[model samples]
Target chain A: MNLRDFRNFTIRDYQDLFAKGELVPRELLTIFLERIREVDSLLHAFLFVNEDRAFARAQKLEEEGRDRSVCPPLWGIPIAIKDNICTLGIPTTCASRILEGYIPPYNATVIERLEAAGAIILGKTNMDEFAMGSSTENSAYGPTRNPFDLERVPGGSSGGSAAALASLEAPLALGSDTGGSVRQPAAFCGIVGLRPTYGRVSRYGLVSFASSLDQIGPMARTVEDTITLFEIISGRDERDSTCAPYPPFSRAEIPQEEEVRKMIIGLPREYFSEGVDSRIVGTIEEVLKGLEKEGLTIREVSLPHTSYALEAYYIVAPSEASSNLARYDGVLYGLREGGEGTLQDMYFRTRTSGFGAEVKRRILLGTYSLSSGYYDAYYLKGMKVRTLVRQDFERAFQECHLLITPVSPVFPFFLGERTKNPYEMYLADVFTIPSAMAGIPALSLNCGYVDNLPVGLQIIAGPFQEGVLFGLALFLEQMLSLPLPLPEIGQQRRS
Target chain B: MPGHVSLEEVRKIAQLAKLSFSEEELTRFFQDISDIIAHFEKLNELDLEDVSPTSHISWSQPPMNPDEPVDWQGSDLVLKHAPCAAGRYFIVPKVVEKEEKLS
Candidate 1:
């Protein structure tokens, strides 16, 4: 098949072809690998491509398909995994120098499930070092540029996974959302990203950022494809103590006309604050209008603690990071920098040389917040504020079924615009953080475009309400009916 | 921000965190950390006296699994990535030299 045909096909489309024996898995894998080789150089989306292994798996699955009565859920589908998620023998670098050559000893639960579903593991995608930054610019390997306009960034630290989907390097990708990592990048790339309620997905193999807020989510070109992958990868794993020990996620049937008419979408006033770009506000209003016309109720709600979310997140996330990253002391696995002194010297030099600037900056910030004298004043206080943030959602949800807002304050910014200003970069996550702080599920989908950059509308549901999110997202998607197309890669270079 | 962390305090933090930076780098970090701290200070404006901290967001804890050791099928894979390993144990620099005195 040609590039356009391959890009346009969704997971279901490929599955139908596979079931009919119309398309060969090995040939499709070859096409995808060839396309990735052609365009990945410009996109910088992947950190490691498991070409030989992926091809082998595709061939094996193809051979087994002849004997099977029913096709597996993700049969023949190639999926990209964020580098932070372990993949047994595959290199799982968090786009950091410290874990440059670290190969995971066991597959993440999600990887095992995908393999069981007969999915081909395409490669590991790039991300911000240690998932510490908003833009993929913090990636030690290099930034994953926006395929639409090369000068701009693909919002991150899940930027590479989103870019991989948008660039057609993979039909589906997995990424961890600590704060707005998954949603924001999905927004910027004009695709669907679902951050399941924290604990909905097993975190056994996903590296921790802020353990409480981190969730492994799926990024895909369409809502159905995203939900399909979400169902396969989500469940309780004994290895992750915090993973909810609930039954396998069973999505409720799509909402009927009466159900759709009864749905109430809360518009949090704090999300449309002055910091939001006028164009984005206009796009949101247009969507609200569309929702209203569809007979859904739209009401204004207040999330009083919205302004303090970024502050609370910076403190909470970094504080958790400092403790989590202490394991990379250069002894067990990953890079080890040796010197001429004691064991202390080796540790000091190893971390110093191994970490990038952004990683170090967060480490210092976290260490300071959790230090002996300041723990109460900083880390504890941040947690209290986090409670207030969650309470805001609880109160707001009392009056509405789901909250609707812009995924980011503005459309994706040009690369380097906010790099020098850490606080400004943090603000890019303002709209999405409150829901994440509440441990609720939220999904981002393309609503419209601003100056050729995609603007995403985020629909949030209370904890474990991913079913509602999917139905509503599909509803909004059909209402908007915006033309989704692959990026004309390698054309623009304004940067 | 009500607090100002001096370079000595930052150095102590680095030591606690098992990290080190040059003098110039420490100075830069001092300022950056201060700026971040200042930004985080906005959280102090809220009255959280009645609010309890949420360490984890799970609604209810799941029952614990039985404690049983699983065979280490991953020993070789884990050892494969180690920078320095002898047998199954990771090797590291000497903690105490023969002639050097403890600090």
Candidate 2:
């Protein structure tokens, strides 16, 4: 098989590629390097690419793992880390000017897990500044263009990771989701992305966006591949007190009920809102019909307080962001002042010169919202609404097993479409945030395409129910047969 | 009523947040803050007298493990991209200094 076939092979298919003696890790690394050289001008998905380092690692893996039980799970498996996540040797710019040359001295917990599994680290992928915007347009490095349409966005914060996976530039990648960063981008880029129950993956080295809300999750071409990667990286680490101890079902224990009568799905009415695109809604309805034809039960349930999730999220997220981001002063970390001035002058120059306008806007809003005098009214009040949102899901789960919704309101829009209107752009996350707010496992998988562009169906379950979530995602794959292709915009330049 | 915040209060908060803006930008920020609080005011109408307020969803403060200082002390070559280091520690200029406020 040549490089085209090499790029297309999933992690599962690679074992055979290795067994056949026709392809090896070094050759695969060269293919990805060559592909990036061709297509990355249009994609702009990566902040850095390390061909020599990646090739060296792959060569070491081939030499060491050749004949020993010392075989590593991801030995030579290529992975791209979202820029916000730190690697000891590589820069960890959160795609903001403040951290233009900043690098962490240690690996994030997720990166440690990936390297332990022997995955090859290719380079840093672009993301929204401090995991902030919905379009990735907020990156100081510039936005990552969707491989499906170079003129469109890859759907942000995690957009670079999603695009890299979609274009087969990497078999697996890492991204962080505070609200919908992981799922929405994966949906737009047409790949499978999992936002595990908050804290399922450790945030030990993740630069804090919202301390309570930030989570690291996996993006992949297939659901089983996502599960496989999630399993390898998940477990309680003493380093992260927030990490939850839970596991998705392994490949060996995948359930096949022998018939259709055993399956059940719940469609919450709040998810089918007024402004959602009719085509996106129609695609999900078609999937529901197909599931029904297979003998599964479908019920329309009410998450009575669903409308309040987004409102609550904006307040709480910014409030926490306001506090967590205060650490990036000119003194301790990140960009510093270059000229002689007062301490105050140094700080003023450093911050004003450092952070982007959107990030500055959030910090100001958040700090004000959480200040002593307003805490009870705004910050504390938003938390009350947050509880009601979680209880609404808990109450709904009592009635149904799985909840479904469109991952975003519409398909991928042109890159600069709604960025000038941040409010309108924030709306893309409305459907996906409540689950994150409630700390539940959610998955986004392609359901159908509109104008040949992909739309995703999200599967959500109660906290720690990732096994159920993965099962539903795999089941949807078995049931949907349309040609929902990966991001194909850069294919001409890729080979 | 947003009795806790005013235009002057927004300026103070922006200073704490480390963002410097012109007088015009400050006015715009105050207006937006007022609008957001006005929307949040709708929640105050609810009779939530007996409801409990939540601080966090699933967070537990990290338990302190063995308290030995793990050595970050390395030029270590691992932190090659960070430009601000002196020996084993990350170096930064001093933070607070006496200042005069404008009258």
Write down the RMSD of all candidates, one decimal each: 1.6, 3.3
Candidates' lDDT values, in order? 0.87, 0.79
- Residue A437 of model 1 has an lDDT of 83
* CA-based DockQ, model 2: 0.43
lDDT of 2 by residue, A1-495 (tens): 544564445676775566566668898788778778877888888998867788898998788755435556676788999998888767788998888777677788888888888888998899999999888899988899888877788898899999888777778898989999999999998888988887678888888999888888888888878987888777677787777544433554445544324656789888898889999999999999988887788999888767677767778988899888777766656788757756677778888888886787778778877887777777877788778878888988988778888899888888789866555677789888988888787888988777767888899888767777777788788678544344456443333
fnat, candidate 2?
0.42
Provide candidate 1's TM-score on chain A. Answer: 0.98
Query: What's the C-alpha lDDT at position A67 in model 2?
Result: 42
Q: Second chain TM-score per prediction?
A: 0.82, 0.65
Model 1 score (lDDT):
0.87
Interface RMSD for each of the candidates: 1.3, 3.1
DockQ of all predictions against the true structure, Cα-based: 0.74, 0.43
